[model samples]
Target: MDIRFDGKVAIVTGAARGIGYVCAEMLVESGAKVAIVDILADTLAEAVETLGKKGTVKGYQLDLTKVEDIAPTVSKIREEMGEIDVLIQVAGILAGNPAEKITVAEWDKVMNVNSRSVFFMMQAVTGQSMIPRKSGSIVNFASIAGIRGMKEPLCSAHYSASKGAVVQLTQQGAVEWAKHDIRVNAVAPGGVLTNAMKSAPPEMLKNAIEPIPLKRLSKPEDIAAGVCFLASDVAANMITGQTLIIDGGGAVVGV
Candidate 1:
């Protein structure tokens, strides 16, 4: 299928690196004018520069932790990139403390960044752009940890909770926005092979990857492909309020 986003404008969060960066690159290559959003100004610049060569791309530095910043930043994006046709919320944080050990502050921080901000950004974008046009696509980041919980040296109770919320948020958005022609979905990645994983202890990495039916970690591009498919009208016009699990078949083994 010729999956192209010829005239679409996409806003991707956490585009400074990892899954978000790959998603932005793919969208641009597919012909969308993409506005990359991240808090890391320097890295965001590098991403824009790298992807700019492929197609129309720009960067905006916005801290998702602060929910207050979501609307204005989205307005700025619409002003600059035109009405948003797609929104991929890949911006998230990880808190690895055990459930009992996790402090209230830590819990709030994780929830704010991983779940709350995603909703507000979607609300802002939908209100300002998508709702008016009555057409758009929204893809969010959920996680296997959220579904099955984490069981490794690093405790991810808070992260799991936040991602669980993200799954529900995506579903709620899809249900409420369907009449407006906005499709909402999510991508759940497991043990992705990113820079962060490369620095992890060998044992930790092994424990993480051994159970996968594929016997491998997911690449950033692997997750990006799911995001792009959900964002592409030609590919996912009828898909909404669902999650595509890109976990190297880890879910099949109940990992």
Candidate 2:
């Protein structure tokens, strides 16, 4: 299907690299004027420069952890990018620690970025733009880790917990915001071959892939395709409160 977002305005967080960057690139290619938000100033600038070649694209450098600043930053995006039509919450962090070895500080760090930032960003975008217009689509980035436990070297209790919160948050937003004509959903990706994954030891990468029904890690584009579908108002209009699993059938085999 040829999906398009011509003339729409979108906000994509954590869009400097990996799956986030690919989503921003695809959105621009589809003709949406995009506001790519990230905490990495240098990388954000580079992303804007590259994506600008395709279509209208801008970058906003803001730390999502500072929840207080989200509203104002979103307001600025509105002033600059026009009324936001879609929001792709793709910014998140991951850590690996056994449940018993996890620290409070580590837990807080992951939750702040992955869970807290997601809720507040949704609130800021929905209230400032979508609710007033009574129209919008939101796609939150969740993980397979949130839905199932992992074996050693990949397990992190706090990371899983934060993603679980995201799944719930997406559902809550969908139920509460449906009356306003907004659709909220999530994309749970598993074992994507991002730069971080590519850098892992060969054995570790192999171990990660062996459990998949499709014995290969997902490309960033694979996840981006699912995200764009969920973020498309025309494509996913009737879909809400759903979590689309883009895991190469890993979930099917209990991976």
Candidate 3:
């Protein structure tokens, strides 16, 4: 498809590395002025250096889990950038501690960063820009774990619960904003090879692969391609409050 995002502006969070990086790269390549946000200053700078030469790409090193740090940054971007045409929320973490063994700190850390921060970011940006313009696309990253129970405990229960909240958050945001023409959707990846998944246990890997018809883990670029489609108007116009599960047909089979 000749999907070109010319004259558009995009903001990708947690873009220092992993899937977020490729999402930013693809958007820039398709002619969008992309701004990458992450807490890791060093990696964010490296990403900027690599992508800056391509288009109007810039980097913001801010803690997404903290609400106070994001507002000024968004305002500054507004002054500098024309408008935020697309918002891709890729900032999250996953750590596994068995349900019975999970700590309060662990649960808070997962929920605070994964679900709470994402909601705040959406509120900050969409309330300021999207609600005003009445036109924007918000793509959230949810996992198959959120869609269904993991065959093995891959991440802490908090991680899965937080992502489940993300699915609902997308729905609420989409339903509330569709009147204004804003589209809020999510993509649930089954077994994408992200930085966090590099250390998955053998049993976990075996279970994850067993259900997939492809019998393979997806690449970051694979998910990025889906993000691109959701961001673009070609694949959908009236699409909102929906989730596209790219699970290699693993999610469809039931006993």
Candidate 1, 161-232: lDDT as tens digits: 889988999999999999999999999998899998889999888888888889999999999988989998
By TM-score, the better pick of 1 and 2 is: 2
Candidate 1 wrongly placed segments (more than 4 Å): none
Which consecutive 10 residues in model 1 have the weakest lDDT in total? Answer: 146-155
Candidate 3 regions off by >4 Å? 195-207
Ranking by lDDT: 2, 1, 3
TM-score per prediction, in order, is 0.97, 0.98, 0.94
* lDDT digits (tens) for residues 88-111 of candidate 2: 999999899999999899999999
Clashing pairs in 3: none
- Candidate 1 at 77: error in angstroms? 0.9
Give the residue spans of candidate 2 off by over 4 A: none
Top candidate on lDDT is 2
Please give the lDDT score at residue 28 for candidate 1. 91
Number of clashing residue pairs, candidate 1: 0
